[model samples]
Target: MSPHPQEALSTPRAAGLAGILFGLLLGTAIVLVRLAVPEHPASAGAWLTDSSRRSAVQAALDLVPFAGISFLWFLAAVRDRMGEREDRFFATVFIGSGLVFVAVLLCAAAAAGGMLATAGGANQQLWGFGHSFAYTLLTEYSMRMAAVFAFCTSTIARRLRVLPRSLVWFGWLVGLALIGGAGNVSWLELAFPVWALVVGGYVLGAGSGRTASG
Candidate 1:
């Protein structure tokens, strides 16, 4: 009636690796989309007319599904690492927020992809609506969910003493920025992935050290 001995080590490795991949892919996609798309929701859909911009947006959209998958894995890894020490309230919020973030992120990508697919001869008004909707979902809605998730994650990690205090503090700051500054500040969305990258690097290093010691 004992758990597998390798469970602890395995979970950290999976979480660390998946988190790193999620951070890299998501950050790259966000940069690409920002460069290609207008920040204003009601702006004219002029980018649709440019083939290079279209290609960049398409490439960013293509990375989204993979990023989402990696994020799911990373979520699982984090939850598993928490084990029995996980608080039920925080767990509910953490899982719920993370899932909502992925859902909105995917929905935003789909909306953008649809717009790109209809680039030629698409109705200008409709294209504008889609563009606005996609960015709204990404920057406004998804980032809010990301903020909640980050806050819950940091709180849980701090409670469990699993992560360094510096990283936990960074997570709290990231969460605050996402909550208060997401839509107004350009490039602020990058905070989520940067947090992921930092946490992932730490998890990977710690996991490696534990494995070596074992």
Candidate 2:
């Protein structure tokens, strides 16, 4: 058997990887659309021509795979604690996050539609700004802040028995720091890439091992 007992323990890294991939591709889509949009280098509508919009849509589709893979990964990790303490709190965070994600997605789709409808209009450039702003807000709400809360809670529940309380408490504090953007531009966002890297490394280290359902 593989060394790790819980799939949830392996989840953070997986979830992190999914978030990174989504960020990379979605980030690229935004950049490309911005470049192509008319009347603005910064506007997403510029690059989002019919063809580019299709590309952006595809990029958006990519998020499903990214999130799905991580979701399963985290699911495995959290399986052990499914009904334990703090599990319900994480559920609350997930629910809030889903709401935020849906709202942001609606905003993005609307903004994309506006850009397409007003391609030739001069005053409609606001659509691009709307997309970017909504993107930022929703992403922060869904992935960054919510993620920190979820991660800290999961780790605390995991470490409550053996790990030092100081370590567990520090993790919770770091998670809070990540959510509040304590040091700079969202420590959560910054930590995501690192978190992904760690997961990828761990999965790699567990070379030839398989993820089995218990």
Q: How many residue pairs clash in each candidate?
A: 0, 13
Please write out the lDDT profile of model 1 over residues 1-214, one tens digit for every residue.
8766576688888888998999999999999999988876455456766889889989999999999999999999999999988999999999999999999999999988887777577776787788788988998999999999999999999999999999999999999999999888999999999899889889988999998998
- Candidate 2 residues lying further than 4 Å off, grouped into runs, are 1-61, 64-122, 157-174, 182-190, 193-214
- For candidate 2, which ten residues in a row score worst on lDDT? 205-214
- For each candidate, what TM-score against the reference? 0.95, 0.48
Give the winner by TM-score.
1
Which residue pairs collide in model 1, if any?
A: none
Candidates' lDDT values, in order?
0.91, 0.46
